[model samples]
Target: EKADGIFILGQNPGTNHPRMLTTLERAKENGAKIVALNPMPESGLMHVVNPNPQEYDNILTYPVKMLLNRGTALNDLWLPVRINGDMPALRGIMKEMLAEEERSPGSVFDREFIERQTVGFEAFVEHLRATDWEDILTGSGLTRDQIRAGAQIAMHCKRIICCWAMGLTQHKNAVATIQEVMNFLLLGGHIGRPGAGPCPVRGHSNVQGDRTMGICEHMSDAFMEKLGREFNFAPPKEHGTDTVETIKHMADGRIRFFLGLGGNFLAAAPDTEYTARALQSCRLTAHVSTKLNRSHLVTGEIALILPCLGRSEIDRQESGEQFVTVEDSMGIINPSRGHLEPASKHLRSEPAIVAGLAKATLANRTTVDWNDLIANYDRIRDHIERVVPGFENFNARVRGEIFYLPNAARDKRQFNNVEGKAKFVISEMDLHKLEPGQYLMMTVRSHDQFNTTIYGLNDRYRGIYNGRRVVFMNPEDVKDAGLEQGQFVDLTSCYREEERVARHFMVAPFNIPRGCTATYFPEANVLVPINSTADRSNTPTSKSVVIRVRPSTRTAEAVNELRRNIDEVRSESASSRSPTRQS
Candidate 1:
């Protein structure tokens, strides 16, 4: 709310985080210019009401004032950039900023901050200056004038908070695109301030928290040393396999055992059919989960569906009822207390499951007392406090009313580099180049879905209702492709000459870029190639997949497949059967 300007890109906070609309409402009321950069004009960014406050089950019980709340108008400007065009869009903005800086000198650029707090400023400026406006125009699908208007809006604001999600992360040039955003922020010194700096939003708070708790492929040396000191044993320095590498190994028969802690791994992973085959190749597959999903249906030779207590379920431990601490996207550590009793009494907590797995795997050779750790969860927090930095007095501090974890980038504008100063990274604008008849297809969640979980079939913003298998394309693109409104089309993506097809997606004429289209996932996940991933992160490039859309060549197999999955999930939900291990 303290920010003068807010730049939202990639993520849809309105649908994904509806409660955030309330915060945006506060910011707008207090005078904040919210700019939305997206391929599709998201209703969440444009106009939205805080539905969380109006969680009344019955319309009859709702008050007049609450019922009439039309909601707040959010975006000052909406930039409909093409899919994978965020890099060029950012570059265009930075180029315009540099021009403005050159024309007015210090009035537009923060010279003192740039000199004192940053390096590579000169090179970054040079890169932006030399960037072709033509390339920016073609790549971003926005004119030079439009780009300048955006820069003009940004130049006036003192504090800017650039927020993004998976839409920005799941790309080939994902890291570079974020660096461009940072470069823009660094130009005006937006770091280390309230309502300013980068905000990478996650669907789940514990996704980021998992990284803090050392559930990563590559743990930092500092974290390893801290663990060694606390546990009296040196943790492995060698990096473990990431999701992509693990799947690759499994497909190649290198990895035999697949044990998932939580989440629909098969559905969430890229190349749906490939991932299924990979799991089938495995000798054993186990998932500690709260509900049954498609993952259970497609398993290895021996599969175990070990039921675990969800975050909303009360975890009665050996000592007492337990709550898990999760770190939000903004680095706020909060204790999550469960309000509901466990659906099944036999279901174990995540900690208990982990401890059991550890005991079974390591036997008597384990260093830490697994039983004691599981008995009192606070003991685990004690271990966490000892190991993780900025977590000093973890149990005491987290139990308080407010606990904000210290962030180096946000707290002091401190960069963890050789020079200990933030470096301005300059990279080439790598836009998605689609061949003729090929549209850059990006997957998105409907208003009714979260990640891989489908809530409903309607996406009111796009005007599609009671339908999950549909593609949103620009009206011009639809006409150009010889596809009419409501036409059933198949999408084909040929990666390394190996073609993958997603059959029968209805055409949804939306306000998207001319050559770009949007489809829902795990429906479109079949088109996402396993090998094509982000440059540095190795994360699947789920956002950008080059595919050609044509009239459906086959039956409604793909669409029917989704319906079957939904029916299966709903059937599983209705059943009283507790998930169990099966050989």
Candidate 2:
């Protein structure tokens, strides 16, 4: 896919995908163009070898050489759209592209690609045609013109890659939002081909791998039957539990054993107070992680913290230097072997740990060779191959260079849907709102943090330093409440009758959007209500919450004294300003 230009939109590669820098650099060296559409600035991706925009702000940067350092691009624009507003902004431009396509038949819509490859496109196109631009602009919080410019670039580009992370996926309508994104890319025929597609930047290295390797509560029938035949063991047929359901079951005392493979469960789950209680109530709590985290401290009466070999650590077994298979972003499966020795002699691999526990607890485990299964990871791969699709020859394919899973990017002619058509679900925007004087509070990860780990106190990207327990608010909101920046505030959520109340978090204020404020996750997770989640996915909408802010006073007398002094001062000022006081 030779092209005159390259566009990277709605993704931050420097912090999230650092390895992509090589491809980006090579593309620049070859005189191919690059365009970035994002809100943040001054990252490795923005400053490629050839300086594109030496002195550029809010607009297009055409021909990189003259503007900055020795660069070769003609023009690139950094279109900054509002937060949680990508859906409407993208849809508006899609409308314009449709209009252009209609004007000139068989132009660049990739008619052959759509007709031969995709299904249910007519229904999708109908939905797009019916979408009102005014409603889109209002919901997206972007001007029609700005979105139109982005659309134009997408339509014109030959090879384009659109990527997004939690910023786009952790929303109430995230599924639909991402679906629309795919729709836009597919409309331009940019996906399923080399050098072009939709990429969801997963947070963890093996999150997708875990899902592919049968780590889900909801297992397909085909996969289950394959597992029964291949392993000769009857796996639990009924769906078990997801993160949310697991919490509910634990709280209700139905699930006594909480066995986590490798995750900061307490820190990752929603509603910190209830999650802590649920974890504490478990009869046997087990955490398999490389390092000790907050979950170890928030353990039950009988708890086991089993350390494990990190991805970078050597997985020594009878079979010599062992490697674990991890599926990275873009569906490429590679064997990840630890180069360093184990942190502790007591450490074990995740699969080994799971097998050991299962053997110890289950009586029917006599039929399975848990030790052999653990010693040779290929056995695990064989089981995976038999159980999961796209892994027909898991051992052979895995032994080679990283290979992609089937039906994810390629084989677009048929979809997983029974009708072989990608369904376009109809949805209406229902933005969360709070009462007057209440602002929408969202949780975000600091630049210095990874998942729940606090690497440092400074968030250089957001202009914060030496502090991780601070909140960002609009300057006007601070002034309206008689508060100043850097002032301490108590964040509180509303109570519903006899239901459990959320914890109040103490935070310092900084400058952000007027009606929108943000706090770091886990610490800020206490503010997120448990029932408040997305419609379809049931994913906790950790990004958005409605809360009230009160001035945090260390002493009750201090608050009382301030109130008393203010009342006295108001009385005196009124007496002086007016004819007389009401004494």
Candidate 3:
């Protein structure tokens, strides 16, 4: 219930969430207690209900005074943990809480509920009992006191909801980290109740729904069997491709064609240079989008940019009017109809575009009615129901404003682990490498940006304006480096990987940890190497990057001044460190 109260607002609804804006608003207005857990505050919903309560307690944290008052005391406890250390800190808290519950056998640990609803509590308990707080704190980069406090707050709360985004998932240990968060919630019996759950705020309007409606690379045996029975054809039983695998195949000259429903695949992917090269190698790269983006421009030898209808744009089909279905972060399926006219008349709906592509690609096939599926979306839902379990009434139940699905946590069902019970994953403090003058830089989104697009140059939450190329550092680090505010510096990484290279980056001083630094992603992504990814999950390790900052010999403005003053004298006379320096 505590984690559920965290709305994670100011995030771009179009890019990050397709249907979460309204639900977020309703949750806030209904006294659910809002905690805008983000670095930048630019979402329109972050209006002033109260002007002043207290000053910003932490330099890195957004001001919580607006949400905190005499009644909403929970808002005052809005703690800003480290950017990428979310899992370690959260898991550490869970471990501590479980230990406390064990000591007090008569404590409110909800063992009865765990036995009935969960499948793997014994192994999970054992893992928690074996976990050491020192490892958790060191891995998370938090003190023991901090973790205990966070755990105490969660335990005391009647309802708790843990909300997280790419910060938690885009790492090597993303799966394990997420599982730990689930374990934390389950330990306190927070699941299957109002105002609390594990909310994975998805990107795109229906990215989760797309996976629900057969967009997954991994097709389970049972799902495949059902699909085969429905279509009366032997559908490919082999696992297809995930986001990373798809790119790998494209890079290896194996995948001849690329088809994206509505994502800026190039911009959203890790290792920009490699992903771009892969796209260039493809025989046919295609995108069905509502707007033109960098991904469309980075095309193959033969590329196609098929414009599609936006969610807010009108959908005029053979049935006269049309609506699209989108699932919110809370698993609620809602209908979205575009009231405004299309940006272009030639644009087609995503479903229509998919149907057309299928018909064109499989012209010789006579199994499925491609055109009929495009006419009514109910047919698509019907096919989804036949294939994907837990979507039994995909056509009927989706008619409501907000309808939930049968998630194991939400439905109070058994845990989906190997042991038929939830497992408390213990993360050991494994230091890859760290040297003197090396700072851990985390990739973050700016208030002016949405995913990969630069909308403007301002971060209201961070209290910055007119720049997306600035890095945030601790005041102490800035002083120690002999660097002041608005100083230009070279941000270099310590790794030498396939796609990892240290380059110059501008620096701006702000409140962060002594050894920690923060930089905007995609722009600052060049500093992070492709090989420096999280464990098992293979997601880019954007959260943790060791960087060295050096005072730049030249400022961005002094380039022209230096160019003008350097006459013909230095052209012929070169010294020892003159024209070239190689490391």
Best by TM-score: 1
Q: Can you give the lDDT of residue 331 in candidate 3? A: 67
For lDDT, the strongest prediction is 1
Q: Give the per-residue lDDT digits (tens) of candidate 3, residues 177-271.
A: 67777777776677777667667766655465766667778767777788889988888757887767778789899998998877678877866
> Compared with the true structure, what per-residue lDDT tens digits does model 2 show for residues 24-73?
66666665566554433425446543333433452355454335554323
Q: Write down the TM-score of every candidate.
A: 0.94, 0.83, 0.81
C-alpha-based local distance difference test score of model 2: 0.67
- Residue 79 in model 3: lDDT: 37
Query: Model 3 shows how many backbone clashes?
Result: 17
Candidate 1 error regions (>4 Å): 52-69, 555-583
lDDT of 3 at 240: 88
The superposed Cα distance between candidate 2 and the true structure at residue 129, in angstroms, equals: 4.4
For candidate 2, the 10 contiguous residues with the lowest summed lDDT are: 574-583
lDDT-best of 1 and 3 = 1
lDDT of each: 0.84, 0.67, 0.65
List CA RMSD, all candidates.
3.3, 11.5, 9.5
